[model samples]
Target: MTKITIPLDNPTLDDVARHADVSPATVSRFMNNPSIVSERSKRKIEESIRELSYVPHAAARTLASKKSRMIGVVVPSLDDALFGHFLELFHSHISTEGYTTVVASSGYSSDEEHIQITQMVSHGVDALLLVGLARDESVYSLLNKKKIPYAITWATDDLGEHSCVGFSNHDAAVKITEYLMDLGHRQFAMISGTLKGNDRASNRLQGVRDALARRELSLPDELVIEGPIGIEHGQKAFKLLMSRSPRPTVIVCGADPLAYGAIFESKVLGVEVPQDVSITGFDDTWLAAHLTPSLTTLRTPQQQMSLLSAEYLIAKLKGEDVDVPPTLGVDLVVRESCSSPA
Candidate 1:
């Protein structure tokens, strides 16, 4: 028998059927169970399949069986050690349940997160865990449509409809700032992660603003600088804030890295921490206590959030009814970094 020539390099089922001179159903039947098809048809179908290289999706069955056993996670960033520690506990929990994690860092872009999550779903993730609840609505819609179990993390208020497990950024910030206010600190400067596309940062910033407003003290627009949550950025922000006419008496950082930078820069600038300017951080990462003056920051329940989120998703995957956990709160840990103005 002569082989058929096809222009299309990546042919579909129809191409195989046409080349074989059989219906698409016949091709499917032959591929699924070659013994059921007549010898004549099988010969032609085999030849057509080889010539056209028509690839039938093999993963379709895996998706139907839900055997991928992979959980997808997308975080705002991986640069923060907080996420690293979070993932460590999260992966440990899920892995023990016979699931592995596939993590993606969106670099705090909502659009990128949507695209990455959609790709993960298309790739047949059994479940998902996302950071914050600030992405496109389509992301949630797609998860629902696909019936994929997911948990929205990093926020205390589940916002009524979307039940989640996380600490309140707003409340945590308020706690730290109020403590500072109680120490008679009035001048406030904040070094924050960019508020754009990041609901946590936005909420924390609002918390500071709210606390300042209540105290009859307002942070100048210039005193607050938003950038990445890295030490260098923190140092730059500290330098800039210190250069202002009336330097900040206290600096509130959105993350521990920023607070670390403020303290480091304080040393370099011949300024004393707590004595010259008080500092505080959020997401009390492990390094917070190791700093020279130590760090006063709000402790995020990373390990608890990770384990609970893992259990929540695993229960959903197993078809077990889960009690949606209430919103978690943060604790303000007083350390050497903060003191009243001298």
Candidate 2:
């Protein structure tokens, strides 16, 4: 007797269709939305699939029906607290709508984002959610070629080419700056993430510029330090700022991470927050509230934004016209870290 090996190729939809004596289209329809299929046929197809333990190919079904019920979300960094919040909320919302989410990290690199987008499309994602609009041309070209439903989050534009669901970083930052300015903060220093590839950071920097411009004050190159949104970066930037001839009385951080870094550095340098030097951060993360001196920052709807973005994209995927605006709004949260300039 000869022993034969059975390959684990996984049973496809064709096996279910054959067992049920129905066409592949019917099986596909039943899998995507069983409500559309007749009760008897659905039962038969499902039973057959269970008997064979069939697992359908995502790509084949998508090619046939032009849908995958899987939404892809691409973000800059997954290690950050904000992005982690985004992933959690997005997953919750997507699951509620009978859809799934696939997340990919771009690591703050356009090339990396492009590669991730390509891989996502190949995996048969019904739609895509990008962190910001700043990406390589190849990304847009691929989206166009595949006609994928995509939405830009964390940033927005006036144009209605695609759906956008987030607040304007420029406006939010300007509001925060204006609030600080009203407290008599004249000299300013900014510890910002690299603005070259990140639209959110760039827009925030522009808002800072616009805010200063209104007061007839200008931000010089010396006052701005561009680096990673890390504690180490913030510490180095703060040290460099302190070395200036006339140091800034207030420091504005691009994100909460940077703000925390600045605060840590200030403490290490024998400076008291809000007493020796006022500090403000963007993205009112939970850590911001839990810090020794709670960070004064803009309250962005990170979780809500994630849910709304997923809802809008899923609606678009289902051929429903969603009336989501281009930009969501943000609020300002004043906390212990910010006060009248010393």
Best by TM-score: 2
User: Candidate 2 — which pairs collide?
Assistant: 166-328
Local distance difference test values of all predictions, in order: 0.86, 0.84
Output the TM-score of candidate 1. Answer: 0.81
Residues 17-85, candidate 1: write the lDDT tens digits: 888888888987665445578989989888887777776665763654545768999998887788999
Worst 10 residues of 2 by lDDT: 1-10
Q: Alpha carbon lDDT of residue 116, candidate 1?
A: 92
Report lDDT (Cα) of residue 179, candidate 1: 93
Candidate 2 lDDT (Cα, whole model)?
0.84
TM-score for predicted model 2 compared with the true structure: 0.84
Expressed as tens digits, the lDDT of each residue in 229-283 for candidate 2 is 8889989998888888787888899998889998889888988899878888988
